[model samples]
Target: MHQLSRRGLFTVAGVAALGSTGALLGASPANAAVPDSPRFDLSGAGDNPVAKKSLHANWVMQSFAYDNVHQHLYFAQVNTENSDRANAGDLWITKTDTEGNELGSMALHNFGHGVSIAVEPYDGSVYLWTEWMSSSSGFGTRIGRFAFADGTVLEKTSSAVQDRTPSIGDTMINPQPAIDPSTGRLLVRYKTGEDQPRIVAFDLADARAGRLATQHRLAERALPSRGAWGAANPFQGFTAYGRYAYLLEGRAGGPSYISVVDLNGTGQSTVVDRWETTAGQSLPGREPQGMAVWMHPTGPRLAFGFHSNTGGVRQASVFVKTQFV
Candidate 1:
């Protein structure tokens, strides 16, 4: 996602090279996917644009992941800004090249709001790893894996769907999936009935093979309690990278923030780093929405995204943190 090359150059950390699975498999891993330092230099980061042309996406972009294989970017957007219709699990996935030229789009019916999405490239084809079976809250009740077929409308009950949702807790609600294409690792962020939010890590291969159902995991870490980010800070999005995971939080006209978590670390304070980002201040209605690790040809990058309403149409933009200190 690093292309300050005047707002452009890279892949989503070997992503959808995780291209819905296989592509992200060979995605390069710098510092073994999870670096000891979850901290990056935000002060020096730039608001590099990933999309060149205007987005054809219909709603506000929620989360996105990369596909290094075909050099495409996948964006997830939910329909209806109204809180009531927001829970319908209906959203559009707009596909585009790294330069932001809209190529095509897909509609997911009754799929949870696209919190976080994983691109897995498998069998010369691509499979999108996302939450499925929208619950009452309009979030995915389980993880769904399916092909990225353009012009296709997939129902939550579609047979082509693969239920990748792991049996985490007795009442796991709204599970989210993030892929560390760098290490082929997957993180599922979920909340229990007690409202305890947690992130569990697993190998992407094992996860794709259904081994997570048997309790095979690399590590588990706790996310901040609900509203812990703050009463005004809305939960935005998250992504997995090697032994670490990253979270995004903020709202329109922000002060957006990025928090890094050590997946393999056992410390009580799993959040080892927190920093406020002013990377996209120039954009109007700059609400932080997406984050992903990208394997740039030059080096490793952490990509963040935002949304703005331009003349009533929700538009999306992206920025990357290329310097890690």
Candidate 2:
């Protein structure tokens, strides 16, 4: 998927594009026809609106992913000289009740942009990936596994690739990560700013072993552009079920769809379904960061979150769907 440009200069803040079955198909009635909106009533997901924005602060709550391992949520909070002084404002994981109260908290370093989260079902640990700047001033991606008592972390450097720029801070950055339950290996997909953005895969099973097991290239395709300046264009989201992986792909001019692949072995991903975004478009703001995150054992439905920039206003949305296929 192509990175859609913003109206003004790009800031350090991360933005995500959203692609849903309904939005991509332009099927307003079908999306509208859902018999029931998400039952956030039980999970206490919808009852609370962040009373004080400062509680979440510079932290975009949606950017963080859920830790189904411990039934908690994890996010980062930046501590500048101006804010709370005692703490440097560290990365935190807190237990989320239906009421949105802070159940427990833990601290981590300042890991900035391109943050993606996943939960390891086998051990009930939360995994987060983001770019970290070392004291010497070099930036690299690190994967941290946060647990109740202790944690395991790994600093990642891309294996030498001929086409892509060596894993830099903000170039064609890494795409989101998805885990295959059957294989017990972490698959990280990334892109390089080549003629067609080059997508690479890394295996997280062996941090001690720094080589990627499988690497494939996403066929280069130009994206579709949204109409108007602030339209609801689509972005990508991913989820894995059994051996099948689902990917939401968006184009600049107009095409968008969900691609399904057998990620179990060395087979090429094929397009199982296709879709388009809502019309009367405008430039889409940040995509849905963790809208597609899911834990297979906790629930059957695939859970997705949406932080909508409706008419330039940020509105939060979450979706849970049972796979029809």
Candidate 3:
């Protein structure tokens, strides 16, 4: 028998089909579950048979978002592979088509750990929402907005980056941001000094117009728990749709989960959906990284991404959960 290549260990053909929407390769795990309200099935087909694609940036992907209007994708990565944010302030922004093919790339200086990014296409141009102002920990200290310029480098304090950190949550720690492409609403998650994890929402237009202070806040709620999953699990990424927020949490290799928070819920009851998924579990060094909403032709897709190492090269692989339960 021929042995599978190192990269082949990550293949999901045993769990999902390529073109079909709801097929599964094997039986559901004993503890597997979907959301109680309405969200994509945890075992929805991993749609892309060839989903693994390389990004323009050589560093591992930290976070990513989709451009529904422009059909583009923006991925964030740091300059070096060390765990201690060795090259933290040095950043790279990779531009790609929907399938992860690199279109071009740019550089950023003193930008925070690219935790999450929101792509906004408007008025014949495109702008990005991401973390900025690298702090001592190598993470961003504020939210920022700027236009995309391939092959160019921008600093955290550059005039092109508009500071968009909202004033609702803890003023100390900078918030992480994601957009609800359906309504153009932006949701940010933040916490201060070991308090409850919090989220605040605002209209992207109001945020971009410098009206965050004066404009009315759309939503403010606490994400009390990440599905009550476990203690060691790490928060990977998050994004919002119409009325729901989807959070990705997991460790490396196996056993990650998606926690669906109903922003309208009160207190600890906010975590309405807690589904454990084995999506991308087979990939080498597979670690869940990002989640976003993709406006697919059939319907909207819940896109989740993972970063893995293939032959010493960091690679990005994206899979979508189409159709809701």
Superposed Cα deviation of residue 293, candidate 3 (Å): 0.3
Lowest lDDT 10-residue stretch of candidate 3? 9-18
State the lDDT of candidate 2 residue by residue for 288-320, as single tens digits.
Answer: 434334443645445444333434333333445
As a TM-score, model 1 comes out at: 0.83
**Runs in model 3 with CA error above 4 Å?**
1-38, 80-86, 226-231, 271-273
lDDT of 3 by residue, 1-325 (tens): 0111221211211101111221111222211221233566556446752266777655768788888987788888765444344335556789998888889877777778787888889887788888889886778888889999887777666899998887642454657889888777787887653434666677778877865652346666566543345446778889877767888878777667788777665554445455777667678888888888998767888888888887777888888887776
| Best-to-worst lDDT order | 3, 1, 2
Best by lDDT: 3
**Whole-structure CA lDDT of model 2:** 0.34
Q: Tens digits of per-residue lDDT for model 1 on 22-129? A: 111211231122345445555655757573235654477888888866768898987655355433777678888766678887778778889899888889888999
Residue 61 alpha-carbon offset, candidate 3, angstroms? 0.6
